[model samples]
Target: MLFKNIVTIAASAAIASAEDVYLTVKSDDSSINGNVLGFPHEGAGLNYFFLGTGSATAFTYDESAKEISYPFAGSYTQFFTVFDNFVAFSVASANTEITFEDNVLALNGSTSNFYACKDTNDPYSYSTRSYELMWYASDAPSGCLPLTLVNSGSAAASSSALPSSTSASSAAPSASTYEGSAVKYAPAGAAALLAGAAAALI
Candidate 1:
């Protein structure tokens, strides 16, 4: 019984320490080749951006909870799709479990729901869009480009792939669009505040 218990604990610890996954787009265009998914440091109303690969966010997917989260200030923030136009990291209940297949991040196994909208004025910032359900790429909103998310491996494994200079200005653009979008950030205790605000409004 003691041996069995120890084995169980080890398995649990392995699951808890899952590998981190990085996200990047797959396209023939050289400019967008090295950009990765990330968000600004400020909380709320800021869209997720395709920052340079060196500064891309690292995420872990919990199969048991069916959720994807990134490390924040000593904790984890769940990724959520908001207004069907942008992705955000917050303390909300994020039920969607993003799956990676053949190097492409899919929404419930469908790849057509993801889109990347470029900011024509700022080539370094590319807004991301994720729908709850599958949406045809052909029917995507104007100024948005179909995105194929690829797993760039964990931090240690991806180190060699990083460019010498990780500055956003060094990143180039593969496409051009003029859509304005922003992502919302909610800290650990923001959920209660949001609930209270909603209750008062009602």
Candidate 2:
């Protein structure tokens, strides 16, 4: 019974500590400005792309750990991961911390590697092709869209001009596809509960 109580407290604390926020981007090109980050479909391992339209994906941002995750996915292992400059969802432990400051998203406190490259085909059929998320060290390939990751709320408040491109009507990925992922964090609440649990054990 004591063990079960401790586990319950720990889980509850984690849930309580998570903050809900949207991952949105902006750029000089109005065509993709104010776009949200999303995946094409529901799958365990899938790459995240940019959607020109539709509601943005709400992610759990653990301010303490500087990690972003989708806790609604039902599995805590799914995290926004980067490999060889490409971004995707994976169960592997995240190696870097992600944070948003001054209305820009930063990785390990730097905001240099994020880029959006156009895909070969339009999968969502919204007439606008989806942009694959990637990280570039120095120069991005020709035609790739440069972007700044920002908090959705901040983006909306600061955005004065609406996208004039026809692609603004592009559909975003369905919410069902956001399942099976989460960000990991060591919440202070959980730590306090653990200390109390230890005292009880003693």
- Top-scoring candidate (lDDT): 2
lDDT of 2 by residue, 69-151 (tens): 65322233456767666676554567778877785778877786777786424333311345666778777878887888777
Where model 2 places Cα greater than 4 Å from the true spot, the runs are 1-17, 41-44, 72-76, 119-128, 154-202
Candidate 1, residue 29: the lDDT equals 46
TM-score per candidate: 0.57, 0.63
Positional deviation of residue 129's Cα in model 1 after best superposition, in angstroms: 17
94: Cα error in model 2, Å:
1.3
Clashing pairs in 1: 44-185, 46-183, 47-182, 47-183
**lDDT value, residue 118 of candidate 2:** 64
List the global CA lDDT of all models: 0.45, 0.54
| TM-score for candidate 2, residues paired by index | 0.63
Question: Which candidate ranks first by TM-score, i.e. highest?
Answer: 2
Model 1, 130-164: lDDT tens digits are: 21111343566565555576777744223444455
